[model samples]
Target: MSDTLWWQHGVVYQIYPRSFQDSNGDGIGDLEGIRRRLDHLCWLGVDAVWISPVFPSPMADFGYDIADYRGIDPIFGTIEDFDRLLAEAHARGLKVILDFVPNHTSDRHPWFLESRTSRESPYRDWYIWHDPAPGGGPPNNWLANFGGSGWEFDAPTGQYYFHSFLKVQPDLNWRNPAVCRAMYDALRFWLDRGVDGFRVDVIWLLVKDDRFRDNPPNPAWQPHEASINRLLQVYSADRPETLEVVEEMRAVLDEYEERVLIGEIYLPLERLMAYYGRDMKGAQLPFNFQLIFTAWNAAAIARIVAEYEAALPPGGWPNWVLGNHDQKRIASRVGRGGARLAAMLLLTLRGTPTLYYGDELGLENVAIPPDRAQDPWERNEPGLGLGRDPARTPMPWDAGENAGFTTGRPWLPLNEDRAERNVASLSADPDSLPHLYRHLIALRRGHAALSTGDYVSVATEGEVLAFERRRGGVRLLVALNFAQSPARLALPGDVAGADLLLSTQPGRDTAPVTAEWQLGPEEGVVLALR
Candidate 1:
């Protein structure tokens, strides 16, 4: 691994605060809840923790809609609580990365309040605002991710502002230099208070088409109830000018020693790599969601992995994600029984891996009843089932009344099977998924080939998956079976001196220079090259 970059050295854990823990009896999670679980995170062997936004918000979009860039939400806790959480995390030898939402702010934010108060307010031009069309409708036909037109009418100002997401989230005008500087200053404030880095939110949307032209029609639109994916998101996101802002953000991180920034970009592999900026001056690691978004097959995964590796520019780091608050958990996506295999693959990959909270224990999405759903995507339109509430369910720590997440009613219910999957129970079982993750992470850290290695696609056929990770004089071979029946794979090359490092099943002698080996259904193994 490179000596200059700490981000390149290890894994990052992403914690969605609302579901992590609830310290108060109010049923909502707080920083104190997170502070109490530092030891658990440390024990999992993650190098750093990337926390989701805790900024003050109207809760219009859960915590994504920011009302104040610099203050913590009262529901999450005060600034003092954040300081305490940071101090505790550092004491536990864990780095802390805060979520920075710079693309837009809640309509209730003071900047927007003043901007909407008058057409001449200094903050009026800070956001993207334009007069309605001749027909008294939006300026353009761009659609919001949450289902309506991207432009919202403000009666007071008689103008419409761009919002790629929820209407409450008005897009910021990054073309305005003052807005750029202000966002950068907010980032610096967090760094000065001891944050190790940031996970920049929707970074590619910061810049838009200067002409405000209508987006071309999307040929790929397949509506899920009322999703706006039907229309192409041309003018709203992934604009070229966004790269300039990324470079500027990178410069800000460079000002502070050891400060890192990762971007959440949802573009295709080709466009996503641009977030690294020219010559690697953009994000330290732009998130790779291929593992989550693409089909789960050996050939498909192999092709995507190869494509991502080829897309990265020199000096740029790569990161992989399997699940997050926005999507279904990996265990649920694959099969509940395949959770350990998924962990092995994620940890053993050749990049920084981000493990979402509750994923370690095979947590599945909550089946939210229609009446209790809290997500705007679901609440805005009934029966669409677009709400992320199912995936954003509360974490299961113990088999207590509320899964040990809180003393009061949980903001979200724990899975009824929590009795079997809770942390306290899983930690006791030697073969539990959580224990498997711990072992897999330790194995990755022990082998240099697993961390910063060059990945080689090993030729194999049938229900078996195989690959080689090599760096310097080290090489490790990884293989997994996807079928229910035993699958045998022919060794790619002479493996006369390979030694077993880790295997899903026990009491198997895997030596003596055999040209073929058998793997049970969903089985995985790592072979250390001699």
Candidate 2:
């Protein structure tokens, strides 16, 4: 990490506002709700917070389909509420980053509304539109990420508007300079209001193939509730033209000091790095999602980590994520016990670590019953299980009515056993997940080796992951047993004397220094090397 860029070294906590806190008693969270939790964030010692979108929307996609670029949705609160939240965040010494959706807009947006009314409208070309095929079908064989054709037909204009997601979210025409300027202006609107940065959504889909070509069929069908991941979306998304737009956005960010832009790109590592731009003037951080895809094993994670560090461009920063609203919770994905090991690595890793809202309490996604499903993707395609409602459920703050989220019924059901896993309960227990998180975060903050150090993989084998973090002359080794039984791992030949830092092994004081160390089931240990 650069000494000048201190923000690059600390932890980042991601808050999905709708589920974080409910201040208005409407059973839905708002900006004011977030404002009330500034102290909690400060106590966690995170340097910044990345909020999911709170922009005006029709709720079709739960605020992802932005309807107004410069206004807050009524459900969240007014512009005044946002100002209060921003002020409180800064007061607590937390930098704020908003979710910026640049690739598409809600169908109900004024621009889209006008564009769809007539072909000659000035905004008609603001979005990608195409005529129907000879057989009265979609212009191409491209499929929506949420299922069905990516293009939605409009009978009035005899044309189809492209939507990479739901039909209601039409893709913006990045080819138009006006669209680029408009989105850039939107970023300025918030930056002017004291926002520290932005997290660009679906950034890889900002542009498309100039020739309206068909995406080839995907032979492997991995069914999710929204859409089948069977088709190769080559022409539909991750186009080469996307980088030009990123450069333009980065230029706008450059005008403001310390304003950062991060992007969400699901492409393979090689292609994902391209979003950073060849000139290294695009998004400040292209989210490293290897942990989300790789299996929970020492060798697998070590190899992926090595590959990602090697793949980064010179001077570019790296970021890591364990969970997001779009996917299953880290606990659910990597098993309940695996969550602790994952958290340790996330906080101690050599990057800007992003912690999902309730991850500190080891929150798992609540299982949503079919009748109560809220995600549009689930509603549109019943056969596929791509819906995100499981991970978007409300947070459990206390063991009280509505999990202390609200006085009334929540929009989504809380975990039935939330009383046992609530923050209030965990905060009282010395050995709770929340306490572990605080210890690890504090340790990371206090030790330079854990925060901005050069990461070196320590040699180990058999269900044990070990690595050494070094900065200046300080070096520390951290290891975790990821299996269900005791595993003996041999340390690298270079290791001499090591002082124990923290260990989850029961009844263990200091682990005996041997060529081989035995780790209990689902246990972790940290040591200072001499």
Candidate 3:
């Protein structure tokens, strides 16, 4: 085996800045806060930290709608603070990845402000702008990902500007060479500052249909779903031209050494594979969310893993994500017991894995009252249960007031069970979820088989999913029980017997196994084959 790159074998930990920690008593997480809490990540054994957007913004989308690409937001901290955080993180051998929002900018951004001034403005074409349709309505039937028409009418200019998300955030015209140059320059600014990589936001939406055609209506549209789902995003997103744009972005990153580019594309597995580019010149990792979207069952998960592995390009690498700032927490999705099993599956998988903040503590989504809902999508479409505040609540460091997240009132409420489901409380318990994660991470780091081995599916019976990771003589078997009842996993005849290395169950003995292994409900185990 060749020497593995850090991103290929390392685990990535995502930090949602606003909820991670608050060091200034400002009731919000900032750069200084992340700097102070770096030790927690070190202790947890994550290789890299991918922080959400920290650029200057109007807080419209809680930092996603960036107004200034180069400057740090005052709420987060100054440029000096970010430099310090980056320097300290590097010193601790932690790779830092920033969120790059290239699709759109805040409506208040200077580019948008100048673009909206008039039709004749030099910057007018910097964004997607067009004259109103014949009936004085939106140019097409495209709908924003958030809600309503993708086009927002600018009364002064007598034209409608297209936005893939909120009307306040206008999509940049990547077709415009100037816009591409400017965005590329913004990337170089961070690369020059020594950031390791970027998790690009809405990367597939960077380009759109050149003709501005109406997206076809979805045949399976339902009123219960978000308004954007009413129509297929054919014309508004995932255009063929988008791949070329991805290649260009990759070229920018290639200018730097060993810097990674991770695109956030929410397409099906087949479509997602194309983002790897013709010769693996596109994104280094195109954020695989299969684990998050797949049915939480043995058969379903096994099928997805097989299909994804088969679909990878010759030189392409794979990655997995269980939870993120946008989705429901894994504990809430699969109960506490299953979370431990899921953690094992993630760490033992063939490729890279990203662990969301608070997942190690088995943190579930907190219920956010209507008055406390901060997501613009939830505010615009009330009662649809689309709010993300529940998943984005502040981290529970301890059982103190505000769960040790803040001395002031928390921007969002903490998990109701924070008293018991917190780092301080759980870290002391050897059987806690955090300990499970630490052990699994250490195991992956220490063994070449677990970290960079080839994967082979193992035959299994009932609710048990089994696979083998082998690098030459080092062979390890992983068996997981997806059901709530006990299941027996039959080993292959080629494997004479196995020795238990680790088990999700707290007190399970690491004894030798012969023929078949019995697995308790929601239990998962790693075995060393004899």
User: Which candidate comes out best when scored by lDDT?
Assistant: 3
TM-scores, all models, native as reference: 0.97, 0.97, 0.99
What digit string (tens of lDDT, one per residue) describes model 2 on residues 319-376? Answer: 8889988988998888778888888888777888999898888888898998889998
For model 3 the local lDDT of residue 530 reads: 83
Deviation of model 1 at 162, angstroms:
1.9
lDDT of 1 by residue, 345-432 (tens): 7888788999999899988888987777888888776677677888888888988889899999888777879988899999998878
Give me the overall lDDT of model 1: 0.85
Candidate 3 local lDDT, 8-49, one digit each (tens)? 999999999999999888899989989988999998899999
* Model 3 stretches with alpha carbons more than 4 Å out: none
Highest TM-score scorer: 3
Q: What are the runs in model 2 whose C-alpha is more than 4 Å off?
A: 1-4, 222-228, 504-515
- Residue 365 lDDT in model 3? 89
Query: In each prediction, how many residue pairs overlap at the backbone (N, C-alpha, C within less than 3 A)?
Result: 0, 7, 0
lDDT of 3: 0.92
Question: Cα RMSD to native, each candidate?
Answer: 1.5, 1.7, 1.0
